[model samples]
Structure formats: structure tokens, C-alpha cells
Target: MSKTVTVEVGLGDRAYDILIGSGLIARAGETISARLPGTRVAIVTDENVAASHLEALKSGLESGGVAVAATIALPAGEKTKGFAFLQEVVDAVLGARLERRDAVVALGGGVIGDLAGFAAGIVRRGMDFVQIPTSLLAQVDSSVGGKTGINSARGKNLIGVFHQPKLVLADSGVLDTLPIREFRAGYAELAKYGLIDRPDFFAWLEKNWREVFEGGDARIEAIAEACRAKADVVARDEFETGDRALLNLGHTFGHALEAATAYDGARLVHGEGVAIGMVLAHRFSARLNLASPDDAVRVEAHLKAVGLPTRIADIPGEMPGADKLLDYITQDKKVSRGALTFILTRGIGQSFIAKDVPSSEVLAFLRDSLG
Candidate 1:
């Protein structure tokens, strides 16, 4: 029952708003139709979430008089963010005979949103898509920006497009059904907002961990507020020209770990990888004298307080070899001339984009963190 925060992505004719609030899912059809006006709708979801809230979502859209053709469900996982599955989902939408006037809905976490959004981007030159994020990670981060693409063997999100959602519906009520482990994983991304640039926000998160985890309305607003912050940045720079890169605060290292871990096959979750990567970025920054060691400690402490991973050892399974960091991290988009352009924190609230971080130094710090 809080105010609905709006982040307008100023794309001229394609500009859209991200409305964040609780109970918003109930009104999804009306809001989505207001922006997306396509008569035919395809609800793309994963098996996990489809079983729980698919009916409610369908009813919402149906009540708004939107005709839903088919509901496509993909298997849930980080592995789903790749070509093979995306092709099938696209096929499903096509089989439904959706035309240029129709739209698709992504109703799940990052995996579904990314894959479905990719389908919306390429199938028939372009179609509208909506994000009904069931997970905190997607609700606050991935589902907002128009960055949609699948992973490649070369790296993560290597094959993607910037297909913005017509509207993003984050139903906070969905959080209660999420497993505690999954909730913790999403919290990593939530903490990342502060680690990247909002140090005071990080401190605030540390003080209110219980309310956030146990489900407090104010904390829900905080998540929406963070989404608004990111939405504003994405609105200004959708294609990551300048300010949008700020959103990738811990993503460079986090992505490298995900690649190393092979998209978390019995290894780590996306947010967990991000948790480890953020700490490494700061530590490597300190090793190069570009960032302070105290900053790294505080980052680690905050991650640990939430029971999130902050080191290599925290990875539950055998992760990628630190000795192979150059090979793994070198695939990042930020890399050039075999050097990783690390996103490092100068202090708790200050971060800077630093390039020329030696691959060797990054490897050494990775080794130290694992111990």
C-alpha cells in the first residue's frame, strides 16, 4: 500500500515506466494493457513459479480483457540463460501464431525474464514484453533494465539485446514462498546496490536485516526504491553507454565467477557469485593501491552478516580454479588487452571504474581469498 515508484526509460516512442508496489500483481492486466495494447498475450514462465502463481496472473490479465493465448514454461536455473532453451521458448511463442501486435510476459526470476525477453526481442523483428518478477533478484535488478540476452560458451550474457519491458510488476507477496537460501541469494544483489555506490544504504541494510528477511512493508519499499534508482539510470542510458555501467558494480567479477563455475552447476548461485566477486573487486583494488583494505573488510563483514558468501571458501562446491582467473575473467566485456577493467570500491560509499588491473594480481588475490 505504498506509493508506486516510477522509473521512466526515456526512449522517445518506446519510453516505459516501471511501477513498483505490493498487490500490484492483482492489477497487472490493466497496467500492462495500458502500455502493451496487444490483443494476444504469451505468459512465459518457469516450471517452479508457473505452478504457484500462474493462475492468479492469468486471472489478472484476463480480468483486464487481455486475451492470453498460451503459457510457456521453461525449466528453472542459471543454465536456462542460454541459446538452446531460448530457441525453444521462442518456438513456443511462434507456434502460438503471435504477430507484431501481440506481446509476451516473463513471469519468474532472472532466468525466465532474460530468456523470455530475448524471445520478445528477436521473434518477428520485435514484440512487447512484460516482467512479472517472482524473485527478489529479478524484481530489483535484471527485470528492470532492457538488457536481454542468452549466454554463450565464450561468456555470460554474450548473446543478448536491449529489449525493455513494457511494465515490471513486482509482487512482494511472492517473497514469502521463496526458500530461505534463495531469499539469501537475492539479498546479495540487494546489498550490492550499497556496495556499488550507496554506502549509507548498505549501512541501513545492515541495521534492518531482520525486517527485510522477515518481510516488512518499509523494507519492501526500499527494494522498490533501489529499483527506481536503477530504473532512472537505465532510463538515461539503456545501452550502457556511461552511467549504466554503474549497475555492473560487482558484475564483472561476479560474471567471471559464474563463467568459472559454469553457470553454477552444483557450485554457486548468481547472487552468491556476485557476493564473492564484489569482495574480490575491492581486495584487488586494494592490492593495486587503488582501493583501501578497510573497504574490503567492511564489504566482507556486511556479506557475512546476511549469511552470504564473501570469499572463495564460502563457495559450497569446487568452483573454478583461481589459477585460471585470467582465462576465465578475461572473457568479460570490460577486459581489454588481456587486462580486466575491475569495478572497485575506494571506500564504503565510493566506487570507481578502474581498468589495467593486472591479471596476475587478480589471480593472487583470488588465491588469498580462497584460503
Candidate 2:
């Protein structure tokens, strides 16, 4: 048995544990049953995840005496995080006659986690939620955050609620089944933790990212560390009211890019967009004299070394114009009262919130970036 590392998100009465390790899916029943006694559940997953992991999860829950009232498998991809899928999950969970005390288990990547969590939040005014995050991105980031929502036609994650999960199960073994591209996409998020405020973690990743990718202790440590970083921030700002917005390090521009591509996975997954956006964030900071150009270079180099796209130009397919991208940025959830708000950095581990940034400056930067 691979060792499991536990990180706690201390939210007082709403506190929860994130368990990271291997074979967690098989042992999930014992854990869930222990934490949420006599709870029935509805499993929400995508078709791809269902084919690969749904049965093992079902068996685990069954063995623990947890009843699965229904299993919902939706289409796979970024597009699945929408109203239609949210409705499908809610309808099924309700159709199963699941009461508020029952649980909703999300059994896929970030999309499923978000969609299922949103369903869990609104159905019967919120049911107990469990996150079984199969993708590296989901395991480290989305699964730990209580922020749940579907993407809007206007912006990413614009429609949702802050419904934290009762438990999170991150089984590294399932990552062996992920494509190299998908794995690389997830690594971008892992690196973001370092860039946010853990320069030492960033440096360690620079020296040991290959081993982290190879799997084993390195990957587990990295995941646990990322979760810990996020847990600390979440505990401090559960509603993203203050320091918590720092968590959106690259998301402002990253989400704009995602919206620009219409959330197309072929052109850009969330992590890849984030990869490019992080580099851009550093470069934009340097452009504003907030950080050194060397910082941008270093960030771009590390991300590129991990096989992530560090430039918007690297995205395949035609991209929208700078004006369109800026328009999308204006619509981002981070924008406060029509004033531009961004998480700009001064260098590694020196991020701060910058509000009232002029739209013209951003427009000029986007034009330069698009060129």
C-alpha cells in the first residue's frame, strides 16, 4: 500500500481532509463510511472516467455498505461544465430520491468535480459532497477548493457556489491512465503553487520535476504541498474576500484565454491556458515595472521545460483578437465593479492584488501579446 498524506482545510465546523495517495479508490468506502455514517450517494462522472474508474469506485462504496442510488455519466471535456450537465446531475441525484444527508461523489477531473459540486450545492439546498479527483489538476487544485460552478458562455466558472466537500480522495494510481498531454497540463497548476508564494517549492520543482512526473514519493509530496498551500489560503479566506484571491495567480488572463477559445480542449485545456497566462502575468508585471524581466524568463523557462505552453502564440487554431480577449477579461469574475483587478507579482513569491488597473493598459498589453 502506498502511503497516504492528509492535509486539512480548517474551516471551523466545515473543516475537511484531503487524502492523497494510491489505491484510494478501492479503500474509499471505508474512509467515506467512517466519516459520513449510513450515507447513501450518487456518483457523478464523465463517460471517460466511468469507463476507466467507475466500477472500482462502486465496488469500494458497496463494500463499505454505502448505497449508490444512481450513477450519472456525462460527456467528457471542458464543455461539460455547463448548465446542461449541471441539470443532468441534479435531475439524476433528485430522481434517485437522495435526501440532503446523502452524498454526491464527483468521480472525474475538474469539470466533473465542478459540475457535480454545483449540483450538490443547489439540489435540496446542498447535499454532502465528496471529491474523487482523478486528474492531477483536479487532485491538487479544484478538489480542494469549495468553489463549485459551471462555466458561463461569457466567462469560466462564473456560475456556481462555494460548497466545500466533506472529503477529497486523490488517488495517484489513476494518473497512470492519463495522457502525457493531460499530465503536463496538470503540472502547470502544481507549479503555480510555487510561483504564488513558495519560491523554495518552485526551485525544488525546477530541480526535481522529472522525478515528480515519474510518480512515487516525489509526486505525492508535491501534491500534498500544493494542497497544503491551498488549504492555508482557503482557511484564511473561504469566500475569496481577501488574501484568497492570490490563488487566482494566473487565472485572470488564463480564464480569458479559455473563454477566447470557447473552452476547447483541443486548442487549450485549463492548465495550458494557465501556463501561458502565468508567463504572461510575469511578463505583464515586468512591462508594468512591477517585476523583473528575469522573473518572466525564469517562469517561462520552467513551464516550457515541463512541456507546457508558455506563450499564447503556441495555441493551435485561430485565436480571437486582442480587443476580444480584453473584452473577455472585462467579464472575468475577478473584475470588481468594472475596475480591473489582477494578481500582479513583484518577483517570485511576491504577489499582491492590483486594483483599478486601467483598461487601456490591459488593452495595450493584450494587443502586444496577441502580436
Candidate 3:
């Protein structure tokens, strides 16, 4: 029953709140039932999470007198975010006879949240969606923004929509079950908010990331701060038309690496790819004379200290060639009609969108980075 910090994503009528605290899952029924009023819910989760936390969630909702009309658990991991599983979830929601007002509850990590949210967005033309994010990454990043979708074979998150959730319950206590690697992967995204604009938060993380990793007050504070940063950006640009694109700071290179790896969690998870991609972005900015090399070094040092993979060389197993990697980059969602767009930096906490960057320069950087 620790104090829950609530961050509001203010989108007028479509706005929602992200509640972060311990024991929120056990109390989820009270909150969700209060918000949606007599609505039934369909719980969409993965096999892994269903084993770990599904019963508790069901018990919580049932205790609050909310009926769980159906439960659909899919196989876990990044591959589950595709047409096949999306169809399964859609079918399950329809099979459950859920109405438009009923909620589609995502009770797992980023994979489950994205898949379930997308299902909620499209089923019966968008039903109410609730997110009970279990992973540190999903709690702080994916669970907050309404960017819901599955991955395309072409690229990560290429096939998604702007479907905001009605409410997001982020129980940090649940993160205790996550493997150390998964937690670290999520930290990459938390650190990203600092790198994007909050030099103070970045410096704070540099000094206190150890405590943040150990969990407790430091962890909650970090999650709340990251949520606040994202809430502000998302509130202002829900569709990523301008400043919102900054949220994808390292995603261009990161998503390319993901596509290169074919979205395999073993080789490179999303956040690890983001860690390496952030380093690459800083280094590439320095190469373009847009930022100082010292900035890139500092970013790399912090990421490496935290056990994140900060370089392409850190990825395990065989990697695609630079040409293939370049092709993947070109296919990134940031690319505008064959022109390159990247989030470059002038220094720490000073990221900006650089559009129409030369593809030739990017190709050269990829070649050197491969070496």
C-alpha cells in the first residue's frame, strides 16, 4: 500500500491516467470498475504472464465485482505480435461476446500490451482498453502512450495505430519477477527520457542508477519521472506529428537492428537494440558534426556501465552486412518518402529532429560501425 504516483496524459475526452505503485494489481478491480462502470472485461495475456500473475489479476477484478467474460493467452515473445495472434485476440473478444463498452485488458509486458491494445482498438471498432503492464519497459514506456500495434515483417511497430487506453495500471512490484536482462532492457527506455531533454534526470540516473536497479523508492521515482516526461509529450502530440517524433530518439537505428535480427528476443530485445541504437545515434551525430564526440562518449559510458549493449559489436551471433542493415534503416517508419530523418543531438539533453539526412552518409556510417 505504498503511495501511488499518478501521471495524467491529458488528451481532453480521450485522456487517461497512469497509476504507478506496488500492490496496484491486487486493487486493480476497484479502480477499473470505478472508471468504466458495469463493464465486463476480456483479459488478453501471454502464456508466461498468465502463469505468473493472471490469477491475482482475475481475483482482484472479481473481488471488485467485475466479471471476467473471457481470457485469451497467447504464446509469449516478440513473434507473437503479428497478424496471427492479433486474429486470435480479435476472435476471442468476438467469441466472448464483448461489447464496445467492455474493456480489453492487457495483462503482460510490451508484447501483450501492444497486441491487446491493438485488438481493443479494432474489435467492434475500438472497445475500452486497460493496460496492466508487468514489465519495467511496458510500465514506463509502451503502456503510457496510445501507440498500439503489432510488428510488420518490414519493420518494428510499422503496423500500429494511435489507440489510447482508458486507464493504465503500472505495478512496479510485479517487475520483481522479470529477469535481470529484461529489467535492464527497460532501463534503456527510462534513460532515454533523460537523454531526450532532461539533463538533470540524465545526470541523476548517472549518479543513482544503481539504486534504481536495486528497486524501491528510487525505482518508483524513476518510473514516475519517465512517465511524466512521456505524458507531457504524448499529451501535446498524440499522433507524433512534431515533438512526439523525438520519442523515437534511438528507434530508427534500433528498429533496423530489430528487423535485421528478425525481431528475435534472444539476439536483441527492443530495449537493448535501443541502447546500442542510442549510442549509434550519438556517434553518428558527432560524425555529422551536429554534436560533440565527448557527448557520444559520455552516453556510451553510462549505457555500458548499466550492462546494456551500447555497440553493434555487442550483439550475439551472426549479423547482417552493412548493406542489408542500411536497407532496413531506409524502411524505418521515420523515413519520409525515401528521405532519411533522424533524431540527432547538439549535446546532452538537446535532441532535435534532423530531416532529409543524406542516405550516402548513413550508409558510410553503417559500414564503419560494422567494422
Candidate 4:
């Protein structure tokens, strides 16, 4: 069965849908054939995901009668979002001699989506692309938003565009094959919607987190609902010029932590970093009197309850250097004129962008993050 969650971007001609359901790949051809501009296609996936899901996707497309010109299996991880890898894809897209009207399909996690979407954004000035996110993080978060870019030596997702996908097909069953670590990591992003401005959602998460983590019926329903929530916000603020910024509740610090660790090669997964980042956001929110300490404590407690890191000491190697984190923050996309744009929460389900915060104060907080 399928659950449909449609989010109209309100850009008139630029609106889209984010379809969440089980066994979505079977409908991939139908989804693409219905929305995309051209029949020629390119599928970009990572090596890890390809091993498990690539054939099914390709077969699905063929069975759906859509012509797939090429399928590129990227090396999984944040590292693949760099120049050489992007060039390889560009070569493939161009070598295929695809037209601007031709579509690109992102077939893996956020990394693939960012890289492939960016390639599509630039190739022939732009091409439509579809997102078929295989990981939970991509499903509920990355896949829907048009924001796509790879990591730089400077920061995680620092080099990306506000480009949106043509269609997003998030099949919850895909999570079963995902590594447990990655599934747990994605949950951090999953919980973030609640952290940003959905108190009731967060409450639901707390009540059903264990079941959600287990990836069953409750998990599927909640994941679809969470995607709907995010899609609702994205549809309203496509460029993140307003409320969309709220999506980064833990991500501001989470991105910094991921950059500080260079994605840490299993040492610190993106979601784990966000888990810690949320704790820090809560701490800073409480520290700055924007949130109640009790609420902050509750956030931390919940993060820990789900086996997510909630403190600096929980990070590896003395929790990365404060200076390193500070440096990462410097390169953050939200930084401007030497002041940081932090997504600090007033409490669960309520976050606001705190701009003009001094680097010195942020550094001071990072210092405290070490313990």
C-alpha cells in the first residue's frame, strides 16, 4: 500500500509531490513518467546501496518502460561529494549526450542526492531530477528539499544549491537493508522535526521512539507523517528564506560536528553528530535563557535513551577540538559577517534562528562542549 504526501511548493508551475509508502520502487517508472520532462534518464547511486537495491531500481524502471541511459554507482560516504567524483558524473551525463530535458535520478542516500542533483543543476544549465532516497535520513529529510551539494574541505554540505527534486519516492521498506548504524543515524534527523517546532510530534517520538527505531508499522506511519511535516514546511519556504531555516534545529551544530570529524569513518555518523548537536543546541538555548534547563535536560535525556550521544565527552578523541568545531562553524553556510546564524530552540518543537551571535561566545560554548 502507498501513502501519498503532496507538498505544493506554491511556486505555481514549480510545485511537487513527496510520495511516502511501502514498495515504492515498483511505482518508480510511473512516478517519473508522469512528472519528468524527458524519457532519457541517468541513475546515480552509491556502491553500498547498489549492492542491495540497484538491480531492483533498474528493473523497475525498465519494467515501467522508462529508458535508463546510464546508472552510476558512487562510492558511499561524504567523501564522494568532491570534485573528481562530480566530474565523473558530469562526464557520464554529457557522454550520454542527454538533453537539458533529460532527467537524473538520485538512487541512494543524501550523498548521492547532493552530488547527482548538483550535476543535474549545472549540466546543460539544468535538468529535472527525481529522488529515490534509500536511507531514513534521505527519506524524511534530504530527498524532499531541492538543496543538493557535496561537502567541501571546508564544511559539510557547504557547496550546494537550493535546487528541488522533481519527485521524491521514499519507500520505508528500504530501511531494512540499511546498516543499523546508518538507520540510527538517520533517526537524529527524524527527531529534528519535533525539535524544531512540533512539540506534539516530539511527544509522539518519545512515546514511540523504540518502536520507531525497530522499523515496523508504527515506524512506517510516523516516518511518512514526519516527511509530510517537513514537506509542508518546504512547500511553504522552498529556499529556506523563512521558516525552512527551522529545519536546521540541530543541524547547525550537527553539520559543524560532522565537518569537525570529516564524517569520522564510523567514528561519528551524521545523525550521531546531530544528536550531540541537539544536546548542545539545547544547552546553549538554556544557557542563553531561550529555553528552560529542564526542557534542555529532557532533550538530552531522550537522546541518550535512544543511544544517541548527548554530550561532548561522548564524542571520540576528547570529543574533537573546540577550535576544530569553531573552524567548521566559520565555514557554515549560515555564517555571515563574522557572526553565526544558529538554530537555537526555545524548547522542543520551537526553534528560532539566532543570528549575530559572536564567534567568541560560540567558541566559548564549543569549549564547554568538550565536557
* Ranked by TM-score, top first: 3, 2, 4, 1
Writing each residue's lDDT as its tens digit, candidate 2 over 1-371 gives 76899999999999999999989999988999999999999999999999999999999999988999999999988788888788888999999999998999999999999999999999999999999999999998999979999987766788999999999999988998899999999999999989999999999999999988999888999999999999999999999889998988898899999888887788899899999999998999999999999999999999999899988899998998989999889888787778899989999878888989888998999889988
Clashing pairs in 4: 146-163, 146-164, 197-349, 198-349
Q: Residue 18: error of model 3 in Å?
A: 0.1
List runs of model 4 lying over 4 Å from the truth: 1-10, 320-324
- Model 3 vs. true fold: TM: 0.97
Error in Å for residue 61 of model 1: 1.0
Q: Give candidate 1 misplaced runs (Cα > 4 Å).
A: 1-3, 319-321
Candidate 2 off by > 4 Å:
none
RMSD of each: 2.1, 1.4, 1.3, 2.1
Estimated TM-score per prediction?
Answer: 0.92, 0.96, 0.97, 0.93
TM-score, candidate 2, is: 0.96
User: Global lDDT of each model?
Assistant: 0.79, 0.92, 0.92, 0.81
Error of 4 at 31 (Å): 2.8
TM-score of 1: 0.92
lDDT of 3 at 18: 91
